[model samples]
Target chain A: MDRLLFGDNQFFGVNHMSEEKARAQSMKFQDLSAVIDVLDAAYDEGIHTFMCTTHDRVGEIVDYMRTKPERYAEQIFYPGMPYAHKYANAMTEDGMVGAIKRFLPDGGLLDAAFKGGMSVAKKDIEGITTLLIDAEMKMFQGLPTPVIFLQNVVVDLLLGLGFKDAFRIFAEHVRKKYNAEPGFISMNLPTLLKVLKEVGVENPVVCSNINKVGFRMSGGGVTAYEKALNEYEFQAIAMSVFASGAIPPREAIEWVCKLPNLKSIVFGASSRSNIHSTKVLVDEYWVG
Target chain B: MIRIGMVGLGKMGLSHYSMVNAHPDVEVVAVCDSSAYLLGLLNRYTGVETFNDMSKMLAQSNLDAVIISTPSVLHAQMVKTALEAGVNVFCEKPFSLNPSTSRDLTELARSKKLVTQVGYHYRFVGAFKEVKRLLDSGAIGKVSHILAEAYGPVVLKPKGSTWRSKKSEGGGSLYDYAAHPIDLVNWYLGVPSEVRGTILGQVFSRETDDEVFSTMVWPDETTAQLSVSWSDPSQRKMSTKITVFGSNGRITADRQECQTFLTDATAAPEGYVEGWNVRYTTDLTDEVYFYVRGEEYSAQLDAFVKRIESGEIEGQNSFGSATGADEVLAMMVADANRDYAGIAAGPAPQVDRGLFRRRTKS
Candidate 1:
């Protein structure tokens, strides 16, 4: 696993804690060129993995990167699937299948299956799930996507709804079709880890909020997270390491280093200085 | 374990469903929604139970409590029905479309001593809570004026209108979005006694106002400038902020952090200097056992469940306080609907509009 992963939240105006900062970022990154410049900056800083939600703008980033392979030879994209807003707009006009059909790489088979039999409708979930994954993966066709994630919104929802098998389905399908590791992004790590272990996905890769203060950590907060990280046999990728800029960088990084079994830290930086500084912080503090 | 039934499967409904379903002390026995697909999907996945109608779910589910996350139009009816069924209710914001109905529901809940709550989740937010604490603790003395503002990207262009754009349903930006900031103001400072110069301005939606601006006047002459806009693309999502100016110092807070300026060292709280002090939401917030979108979401649900178990009819976001917010909203509605000439808008005892203060020759 990459020790330093770049995230797209800053470009997408998704500061979890501060609206003012989010608005400022939205204004700063309205142009695609600004986004590309930052990505190039991160790449120069030796952070190659870009973990991003499959927002429409990401397609443009993928296309831009595809044009110059040599320039971004080592750069990798970790795509998170099922951007809800992308589906929402289309769902309002056409039904779910119609929305899926618009994005499905090979809609003909799914369309015929839906028309030919009612069986898929009854258990349309797995069928639709694979199709949506294909649809989202289409944008990253030739790119190296080593890991793919189910967004926390859907993963947490599925977790709450008690469909433990969905994790297995997501894992198996991703492994079989995309040749990538299936990762789950959730707010509740302990509960999700238990479910993944039950579903037989050993050493699963889980990304969540890992910080000193219990900002968004759920399922028994900081102490429970400490217990899980120490005991569980899983790769933990810490996001929101600074708790959305609430905690100072040195303090946040120092605290996160104390946790056991941490595989990586993903963060978003809008400037070259920020990227450089964060990389330095991680290197300086992660000696343990 | 508390046997709870969920109604509605919209965006908020789905979130509430997840939190409640995962809660250890609660069992989501049945769900109700108008969407066949959502209901079918939940039934297939969880196999709890599903209903297309609220009354049917209330009758058959044998629920200890029902969480109503439907549109504002349905809250009054569903809350009334749930109360009559002898189950606690957690209704979404803008408790009722009409102020009178808000009053009646509060009265009915009080009479039955049923645990009731409104979904003003902002009350559970840490930064906003700190704002309330600072005010209640007399850290900021004799607040004279306040500026409450909310902006969001709900309506960026003149496009299709959802239920939120329909004024008749009390689903306009005023009720759906602006009510959040207004609730914050009401929570910090009591509900204003007078609403003046209320302007329900429209920027995008033709069916309803996309922006709401009003001046809220308290009984003691403290005033707040309420400004809100849902047609702002600059904001990625809904951002509510408040700025208060008092005799001693000033205070400003949003969902993320609270900043305070103290003129004198005497007014400063512990670990705070007299100049400027900031408390981030991360430090201010407490951990929730089941975290979703935000801890506040789970915290509110936790509070509601605890109240129900403790048999406390009044707690955070009680129907009584919600009614206060609704009364202020009703005042804004009336002020916006009324056509005002300059003379008539003049404060009593009716000053003539033509009179002007003498000005020096420029």
Candidate 2:
């Protein structure tokens, strides 16, 4: 993984502090060309890792990137799966069977259907879980996806549901099938690391809110996160490092870069200057 | 009598079967379903020719029309095949999963001069129809804003087991439950020119959305808000309600009743006056030929059969209407996706209390 992973929240219009700014950013990036332009700026700044949700539009970006292989040769995509909105929209339009048919990897319909049916009949969570993973991974086929993530919504829900075994199922399948590391994003980093360890996942790459202000960091806030960082063997990717713009850029990056066990920081920006400045700051403060 | 072929013996299929079979001017000549058990049952009851394949049914049925109640993903292909086979089509909503496909089907139907209808039964509901009539008559002058809401308790759990929860097959509240109110919006006001502030989220369902909220603006400057939910426990099975605010007054309508309140004297249809007026669906004067779970279903079917028999190519509920509705649905979904990905600012600020007082005093 890169030391600094570029996040897609800016392109997608996700601002925790100001809904108005989010909407404005959303209107600005309605065009794919605009998104590509910003990404190019980030890439020019030497930040090649893009951590993104599997929104339907991201599929278009993937297709565009695939067309220009050399241009994006070193580009890495960290696709977060079961983009709940995509599935929700698909299910709304096509129904469950139709949605499955639409999203299932090409040439694996029967196998997936059998697996799905068997999973339903026999309570085979592994089969069902892997099948869904494959479905979500369909768009990333033929691309450079080094790390596939389970989105926070599902991760937190499974955590709440006490479905700890799913983490192992996801990790193993991602490694075995895609040959990629399976990453988990959650609001509660300490508990997730605990669950990942219980499921026998060693040195897992966990992404969560880690910043000066402890914005959205739950289950004991920054104190618990710091303890987890010191105690756990897993690599940590700090996100929301801006604390939803509550903290200054330098102070936030300065505080997060000094944290123990922190391997990467994922941040979103729309302009080249922001990207370049953030990159400079991270390089200056990062010990490694 | 118009000969009809029934396709897909699911819930909607059986409902259409009963309605078509009961209509005096229609004869259900054949039926098609993947399940032999359902085919056998229908054959035993209706004595109609049955086929396991749609192509076989289309070739041998000698039907004048086909009523398609299959999963929405199958609509484009089925409607295209039926229309190319020279049979009119009455497809269940939405017209197709994609707007382009829906447009293509509509073009084919138009080139063939076929009578077509998309099942937006709410349009046929007496209360809604009256609302439409009132709007058309300018009962509420210069409409400014509208709120269309459809809520039900269909998906309350983490069950992503069905096609309704999938996006590929057009399974979500946006397509299934929201399409009604969306179609109503398109019918009452033109298709929105701009859509923003969309929020499509899952409440309890694992994969698909149980709630959708969006803001749409028409070219006429009429802004509308659409909120559809399949996870609201407070709602009945399927409740569609709309409130229209115009310069003159406001009108609110659901399946059972239409209520109106006029602030000043305005021209309204007969039986409606200047003040508060409420009309129950039973008071509707337009006679529906048949009644089932809803008169709208029967009325839409009756209109389709009548148009086919009379060789009329276009009218309300035509392919054009369905295609228009499908386009608007596509826009709403697209905007919702954008909005979900788009940033959220805080809620728009409220009117200043001092300004409000000053304006009132003036």
Candidate 3:
């Protein structure tokens, strides 16, 4: 993990605070080249890690990156799995079996299918969980995926359902299978960390809403998040640092960077200046 | 009695087991399921031997035939194993996950001279059977086009965890629900020579498709459209209907009844008249010895038993027909997988010059 990792919310049109802005961002990034151009700008500025959702269009970006290997030699992809919409769309069109066939690794079809069956029949949650992770990670094969994330949609749902063991299952599978650190993104960071610890996952890397003014921070707000960061040993990745454009760049970064044990900040920016200025603020404030 | 061994005691398997048990000519000698709970329940109640493995059931039970209700992915292997054991087989629909494996199973069954059937019970539904009869009798004249739809509310939300929603386990509406209509089209109009305009969409389930739309052209040039969805909330549970259009009239049929409309008196069945006519499935369907879901299930089982007893390996719902349908489905899936731009780039239809000339003359 670096001091700043480029987020994909802007490229994918996911603005939490404003639906109008989200729609505008979606229209702007309909063309893949526009997304690549912005990514190129960020890359040129020495920001290489792209923590993105496993959207279908992201496959195109991954393919594009493959073509220009030397240019993206140091690039890292942190793919969040079970892209709910992609799977939903694929399942609606291809059917469960057909969609699995479409996404299963080229040569591991039988193995994956067998694991899927075992997962279903034996209640092998580990098998099913790992199989899904494998399916989600299929497109990122041969790429630098040092960290794979469980998307917040599922993370929070599992949290609500009290399926805490799933966190450990995901961690074990990600470590054993992809040899990558399993990261979790959630709306409630304190609860997730507590559950992750209960499941025997120590010092886990978690990303959550950790901005100034308590925008969307559900579990005890900014004070509790700061206390958890200072007291807990887990590595923290701060997201929603700008509080959906509510907080000023300098104030938000300065506030978040000064927080103890804040290992990195993930931010989305469509323009070079936004990316560069955000990076500059983090560099200036992050004394460690 | 023809001794039968049942495998995969899931919903379909249990239904088939009771039907087979009720048949005087068929005896369910043993059952197999991966679930020990289901196997134990069957063992305690039925007094029939049970096994957790299909091969053990096949080997231990002195079976003349095997009924496979396993998931689609296991169909080929189970059917292959039973056929190689010289036992007749009645497997469930979509016979195999893919075409090549389906072809292999069909070829193996043919070589062994086994009485094999695929559980496409819709083929035995009286209304659909009547539809087939009317089509074959030319009551609707030369068939020009057909529309087959199968809709159900099995998956209306994100169900990526279930085997029915997972692609690896043969989940998705395409393999699960659409096969019925695709098979019906194959039975009504011979194998399709070409397929185009496929749209596989997802409504709810994240891992597999809940909706499938595709078009096929048969050898005789008659076209058919297939639309299947498992996510439509308004649909009845597993409702399958088909409409056929011909030069003279059109016929429509579902699980309940078959209806036909004819312009000419000459193009009607024996009891049917020119205008519109309807026949309820209860009237047309044969009396089943045991009924679970519908008479079609018993009818299909009886048909399979008769085929096995009489050594008639080829028929309406035999493995041969199933393989033919599987081949068509595989072709449709492959075509659907092809670059959509190719189909999207098709030329616009040309104007009818003869119609214009006739208008000008008039």
Candidate 4:
């Protein structure tokens, strides 16, 4: 019997700078060789596939990955995106720091600084869109990258736009400019599938949570959130297997086993022990 | 307290570093490896001092013991060096590539009366501990037969002409991989009175077979089937498992994960032991007395320190802890060789996977 499809989900948020810096710093002692060694160990441990979110770093590795496709070909999965850029220089350091501080509880000066920092991050997302979009087009043509987008329930009240209003703009941009099919843009609600159904997402439809679902925390563990059984008619994804460390492997496997509607379950192992445990679950549940 | 030094800063060495350093009353202060790269890795990750030379590291560390986690071929030399330094030692599995070197290492440990331990972490897993406990308690009366299965993906990829790929360096799957379960079987049940197995290199392009299957017959007429493989595709990992068949009951242990469940048929409701309902109740985790038996790696180190302090290591086989591991590897290697030869000569090892299959119709 074929095992259930399993892949990891990794997307970059605005914390990209810090993450790159960390990797770059580590590369002083352990360069791409170090990363490759770890990746090889993972592959040897049976993690045959890795899903990299659309980001500049991912683009670099994907290019590296293409060169050694035999070693990495079956292993890397690319998810495309409509890049959102944020401008960092436009905001002063003190202004950014002040906003971050304001967002903090009790609104102290330090907390206001934290809020300011986050506002800059928000602004940065908007600024990166053009660069991200250009990279997305190049990636689609050159590689197996699948486009990914995001959908929220309501239109922008500030802009007085409906849901379709924003989507239509992006769709037109993709079609006229890139001349490529728009792939999956995850939606906040399954009901939004109605709008996407009209547009026809060529890529697979993935279902995640607007917030945490399931037990202890909302929409987290499978014990609490049953699969969206009523919405089973749509091709769906089961993401966030290890949303909380509290859900034991046995519980997760049992839940996934019961979900007949899911095309696949997405998860990953970050350590050797985790790989061992996940193998046990995969052998027991998916392989049977 | 046993003051110990460790060699090799690889994954296994790091594991030893953590285990030894974490032990109370033990000091793991000195580490060594020829690979400056690996030494830097261990130093950065473990914060232990490193030496490029094992001899210097041993002599200068002022330690009572050493753990050799270097390559397999280096195990014998390292163990001998530590023993000569009047240091008790703990060496990792595949004690040696061949029986002669293993025997020599064992003899040295015995003669020195040094506190030696072989790194066979599987023996400490709670699953087998429960199996031992249940059998001792007569929950599974008179263990008459046993079967062990081991397989993983490590064997399929060539160690690529490294020392691990050389027979002299213990490159074969049987030596490097099967040693764990083989040692476990030998520990749980005495050596097989008659051993035969089939080894297959059916996957990897190597001088040795990457997969193996064997059967052993105990003197008491009990039988065991041992299946070991390194050709699993998804991951180079394994689930070392065993099933003990006894007069009163049967137990299944997925030992690698430290999980086991058992059932006694003779003690069953209708004297029917073959079903799920007959499972004898016990917490497998609790049954493994590592926290009490003082058999944990740390506890083993503490014991060596005690021996050093008491001057009582004489006649004790310390570094020969791989005694069980070596024997298992030897047996698996022997069996695999015979199995492989037989296959190449047009006969295959006869196996019946269904023998253990439950009689569901009844």
Candidate 5:
């Protein structure tokens, strides 16, 4: 039976916590540890998936999994760079100039990485690769233990990266664009689906509500009853189920039940009241 | 007791039909529409007499007021006809295409001393009343910036004219969807000094613009930005949400349902409706009952009737006024005519890059 997954998506005291406290907490548990705690709580509460941000957390998450090799035996971190999810440390006031000097070397590290045959240590390559994998795996582990990377959006930004590095490129794209615009994290469903097919992943694309909200607010085609959302090729996490709140509870319930392959909804509410309203999915909707 | 007549048999019309039919101080004695099927539906739904022609229904029915739910363009003529025949009028919005027409209607109703109401229902929403209270009480201090968004696609008719595709019929996203926000912003800002807007045919390749965005400046030098569109592809009903920012706090309201917020730097308390009835009462005078005692429709209709009976034109005019709807349309039209470079040449702007961003480093 497909059940609705609901849980807090933000940290405790998100509203009440001071920015200093939040920053300190984020820094103290700067790596995968923070993500693990959240996922553990969410999983225990029946939340099967979660999203992760931060580079240090990536390494921390992978390191924790290393201690439990058996639990992560079958898992594979999709290979990619941390371009999209780059660490703030990489561009800090102190680090930016150094990075430009070290990587760019007058030309830039991005330019240098493409120029091959420069003698490189296996240790260095492995270390960089490990950090990259750790980041992706940390995000992965935030999902249910058996969670696999479901190529969610087509992320046009990920296009052209070779097959082996497609997933890594996808992550980089996310890191790069997540906040460049209001709905940057949202990828075109149809495009993402096509890329996922080419990448040969059978994992379902769980559509997010980030784009849907923006599109809906702009009076875009997001509301088309026949939009790509209703198409059979995709599965979705109705992120905006409580979108307008203008829709009667009964009507929203009926609408969700009619979807062809709707798996679950990723509620985006933050307030306690908003979180409570999430019960509309289980109570009023799937009660029958 | 005030006597009333009803027109149209759609959901809104039927709602009013029942509202008046069930009122103790009011009676829905006559009804009219162009559809016999609808007439039959109304007959089965209510005990009132129905007619195919409005004139016949108006001439024969012993009514002191008429509720119109016909298409927007027909509102003015029907309202004028009803008033000429000595009937008080309650009609729906898009308040006759432009401000001049709305003014003309208001003047005509005044001269005849007819009680008139134009349906801009959000005024009755609980959240809005609270927002008004906050603005009045200096809860948000001197309001400076306002942003309103109301965007959603048109629910297309199966085999009828898509009037929203034409400019002549007051058809377009600007006049259709923006009417609510225009009314809303104006209601909030009193009278804005200057209005500038952009209307475009973004998704719909039809004749009229499918999307429109506007920025209005109030007399107090406060500014408001509104975005409206009819290109939403989903079948979901969307609405206007207004966010007013001031020196001390911010207030946001879900325009249709009236869910609201007012917060200062320390902590923001959000209100929720609880208990058996789930009535959302505020820290204000207006109490919004989510589920009206099954008597709200009748209550509003009864109010309309009392306004006519009392000959209190000003009170009814203020409550059901369509004063700001057309000015928004006029601004939308003017903004649509502006060149992109022209707007860019004029001012320094604040741009919201959005909430999330990629981490560049550790």
Candidate 6:
């Protein structure tokens, strides 16, 4: 994994610290070209992996990147699955059946429906999980997706609900079917790590909140996270290192870079200068 | 041990069920919802009892407490049934559409000596709770003005109607969106005595308001302005922000952090200094056993369980307090439709309706 992975939160109007900034960026990136410009700028900075949610707009990015093969050959996507809002809108707009029909991968629509439908009918976690994974992966067919993530919404839900077997099922499918590493994003690092280890997912790639002030860190906050980092064998990706811009840039970067087992740092920025500066901070302060 | 039954398997319901089901002292014995698929999923996964009917669950599950997350229209009946069955209740917000129903339910809960809590989860948010602490501790002096605001992208375009757009079912933006901040204001400065300058504007939905703007006056003449809208595409999700202006200091807080400006540190709470001080959510929040969207979500349900164990009849966000907020909402809705002649101090010029007049068909 690259030391720095760019994220898509800023382009999608997600600013944890301030809504005004989120709205401004959202409006600025309304044009697809603006989004591409930022991605290209990240690429120029040598931050190639774009860890992004599978929002519908991202399909446009995949298409645009696929067109310019040699120009973006090194860049890759780390797509997160089952963007809840997309499915939510679909569910409300067109009920359950319509949602499944709309999001299933192309071709053999009836066959796909029968398989996915039977999963829904039987309430099989693995069936629905793979079906949705295939659906989310459809847009990134030819893209280099070395890592696929289960978003925290469902991950923590499953963790708290004590369905630890789902982790094993997800990891097996991602490895056997897609030949990619299965990643889990969660807010509760302590609980999620315990579950992952119990499920025999050794040396897993897990992304979570890791910062000095413990912003958004759950399951014992900063101390528990530090313990996990020091004791655990898994590779950890640190997100929200700046605490959504609440912490000073230098302090945030410095604190996170000193952590152990830190495989990558994912962040989002709206400008070329911000991206360059953060990249510079990681380069200067990285201790491991 | 407290045995509980979960009602309504929607978003909030499912979230609360997950949190409370994992509590060390609480057991989610049965799950109730209209969808058989959800019930089957829960029953199959966890080997818990499942019910399609609320009363049957309340009776057969032998529940000591019931957590209700149904629609606001159904909250009144579900809450009353749970209370009548001698079960402690934790319900989602906007306790009931009708203020009278809320009042009667409050009475019923009190009469039964049952623990009752309404899911105004914002009250459990660490920053918001710190704001409450500041005001109560006199760190902000006496608040004379407040600005409470909420915005979300629930309805940005002309969209088909959902339960949220129907005033009777979900109470539109006024009840669904604005209730959070309004409950905070009510928590801070009781219910307002006078409500005027109300505007129930419709941006997209024709059946109900998409935005609610009103100014409320407390008995002490402390004024608060409420500006809320669900049509703002800028906000990716729902955000509730509250600012209190006091004689000696001020406080502004949302889900992220709390900012307090004090003139003097002499009376300020410990760990806070004079001038501007900011407290991040991570610093203020206590770790929960089961973390979901936010710590507040789990904290609220944990609070309910603690209340049941401690025999606490009065909840910080009890049906009684939600009734206070509901009364204010009732006043705002009424004021929007009321017609009153302004008291003109001097001669006013007569004006034609012009473009302001409704276009009548020929």
- Report lDDT (CA) for all predictions: 0.85, 0.79, 0.78, 0.52, 0.52, 0.84
* DockQ per candidate, 2 decimals: 0.44, 0.02, 0.01, 0.02, 0.01, 0.34
lDDT of 4 at A143: 57
Alpha-carbon deviation at B16 in model 1, angstroms: 0.4
Error of 1 at A226 (Å): 2.8
lDDT of 4 at B47: 56
The numbered model that scores best in lDDT is 1
Give a tens-digit lDDT track for model 4, residues A156-250.
Answer: 11011112433444544555565543433332223234445555543334444211223111212333234443443455555455443335677
What ranking emerges by DockQ with the best candidate at the front?
Answer: 1, 6, 4, 2, 5, 3
- Mind giving the per-residue lDDT tens digits that candidate 3 earns over A123-150? 3335555667877788898998888899
TM-score of each: 0.91, 0.54, 0.54, 0.50, 0.49, 0.87
- Name the lDDT value of residue B226 in candidate 4: 74
DockQ of 3: 0.01
lDDT of 6 by residue, B119-219 (tens): 89999988999998998898988889999999987777776544666777865789888888889999999899989888999999888899999999998
| Candidate 4 chain A TM-score vs. reference chain A | 0.57
lDDT of 5 by residue, A136-193 (tens): 4444443333222323222322321112234443334334433110111222344344
Question: In terms of docking quality, how is candidate 3 classified?
Answer: incorrect
The better candidate by DockQ, 2 or 3, is: 2
**lDDT score, candidate 4, position B351:** 55
> Cα miss at A225, model 4 (Å)?
28
> Candidate 2 — which residues are off by over 4 angstroms?
A1-288, B285-287, B339-362
What's the lDDT for candidate 2? Answer: 0.79
lDDT (C-alpha) at residue B110 in model 6? 96
Weakest 10 consecutive residues, lDDT, candidate 1 chain B? B350-359
Clash pairs, model 1 backbone: none
Give the clash total for candidate 4.
Answer: 52
Model 3 per-residue lDDT tens digits across residues B227-267: 99888765424678899999989898887668899878585
Give the residue spans of candidate 1 off by over 4 A: A84-122, A246-248, A284-288, B342-362
